[model samples]
Target: MEENQINELVHSFITYDYNNLSINTEELDDGKFFSIATIEKNLGKQIFTPNFEAEFKLIKAISHPEIKKI
Candidate 1:
C-alpha cells in the first residue's frame, strides 16, 4: 500500500481506540499516539490487520477532517 494509505489506516485504528476510551487529544500521551509498543501492550500480541470493510472505513474516516484529528 501507499505510505499515505498506510498512515490513514494506522490513524483510524488509533482514533477508534481513543473514541472507545472517551479520550480527547489533550488526554492522550505520546505513547498512545501511533506507537507500536502501545498497541501491542493494549491489544496483547494481536497485530492490526485491516480487512476490506476496515480499509474502507479507515479511508473514509481519515478523509474527514474531524476524525483525522482524533
Candidate 2:
C-alpha cells in the first residue's frame, strides 16, 4: 500500500479503537491506544497481504464520523 494510505489506515484503526475504549490515556494499560504493536499482535503469524480495495472500504467504514457510540 502507498505510504499515505497506510498512514490513513493506521489512523483509522487507532481512532476507531480510541473511540471504542472506555478509557484512553497516555499511559499504557489494558486499554492502551490502538497502535502498530497492537496491530501486529492481532496480525500475529499472518502473512501481510495488502488488499488496497478492501482497505479502502474498511477505512471509509471505520472512519465514519457518524458512528454512534454504544
The top-ranked prediction according to lDDT is 1
Each prediction's TM-score against the native?
Answer: 0.21, 0.21
TM-score of 1: 0.21
Candidate 2's TM-score reads: 0.21
* Cα lDDT tens digits for candidate 1, 1-70: 7666654223444353544554476855532344434443444333544443355355646565654443
lDDT of 2: 0.44
- lDDT by residue (tens digit), candidate 2, 1-70: 7666644232234353455566555543433344544444454344333553355346556664543221
- The global C-alpha lDDT for each of the candidates, from Candidate 1 onward, is 0.46, 0.44
State the lDDT at 18 in candidate 1: 42
lDDT, candidate 2, residue 68? 22
Candidate 2, position 18, lDDT? 50
